[model samples]
Target: MKGNRRSEMSVTEMFSYIQGFLSADQDVREDIRKVVQNLEQTAREILTLLQSVHQPSGFKEIPSKCAKARELFSTVRTQMAELKTKFPVEQYYRFHEHWRFVLQRLAFLAAFVVYLENETLVTREEVAQILGIEVVREKGFHLDVEDFLAGVLIMASELSRLAVNSVTAGDYSRPLRISNFINELDSGFRLLNLKNDPLRKRYDGLKYDVKKIEEVVYDVSIRGLAKEPESGGDK
Candidate 1:
């Protein structure tokens, strides 16, 4: 009877240990969610700044606007770094989808800043470094391609609007350059046999962006305003 009672007690203890393990897993996820939410809020603020920066601002003012957005990006990057360190073991990829929206937006903002400054597209590798994340393949996690591509799509739309706004603000050369940039991006996207549904939808929206920029270019060219479309390469 004594041995049987001991065996039953051991079974109960093992069950409790399993329950505790599951409970800890839940706690970890909850903690990650809370942090991600905070990061998401910050990312949204940065996006707002990026979206608004090109609106009738002086060229001298643009650098300040970009600087402010970069400051917020730095904070978001720090939070991401912390999350990477504390992300529950074996659950990094699983939890990554939770933060996908914010991550993609952050990626867009990083590239957008570069685009605004240099009129060039930021490469995926440069964005990964800016975000302080690795692009590991074997038994390691990397920044999702779909996320970065989504950001670029979003950038395309913004640049379309920027093209129009730049013309209004007396930067005539920018609209043609922007039109060319969108066309090039559209061509690259068309080459990909995309399987991601959300990415495909965003790629579909690229046509609208392309058309809008084309209209802007046509309007400028009809008025004899824009210079020749000589800036071809992505610097």
Candidate 2:
């Protein structure tokens, strides 16, 4: 009877432990929250830009990609400015600092790597979308952003595995997954620069959503990578 009671308590304790760990997955929550916030900013800035371009804003249900892009550009510039001002995180394990960054970059990479390694060809529309590519129109297909996210999510898993190590290395306010994404993102931005187009110079001036995201990504990464503040200097 005593053994049975002890076993029951052990089971209960195990359940509690599992729940506690799951609930306290701070990195998971933080990464997700950051993603959500960035998406929010994207939507807002995109809206403002689109409105400016469209005049009526919602005259048509499906707007042109150019209009959408213009909208995307408008708010991203301003939002990024605000993000740069709010230096929330101290360490930049994920960046020079923390901000609205990808929780999905590493994961996206991981999933893509696996699909390639396994010779698994993606057939779904959603899978291709998250990869930031065009997809085929299939019969009876409800293709949408969800499909892309699904594909990207597969990569995100691998990213999480590689990135978690960095977080373990650093204390709170440092996440390596975020750092890796930012680093890659920073490289991507510089690589995409065009110098010859009519709007090349203007593009440089107009804030890309990429740059806004960078601010947050760099912010987090900076906090993680920054040298700890010197102690006993003047205070």
Q: List the residue pairs that clash in candidate 1.
A: none
Top candidate (TM-score): 1
Residue 44 of model 1, lDDT score = 83
Task: Encode model 1's per-residue lDDT on 174-207: one tens digit a residue.
Answer: 8888888888899999899988698999899999
C-alpha lDDT of residue 140 in model 1: 43
Q: How well is each residue in 36-71 modelled by candidate 2, as lDDT tens digits? A: 477465654433433332222222222353345534
Lowest summed lDDT across 10 adjacent residues in model 2 is found at: 53-62
Local error of candidate 2 at 56, Å? 8.8
Model 1, residue 104: distance off in Å is 0.6
lDDT per model vs. reference: 0.79, 0.39
TM-score of 1: 0.84
Clashes of 1: 0
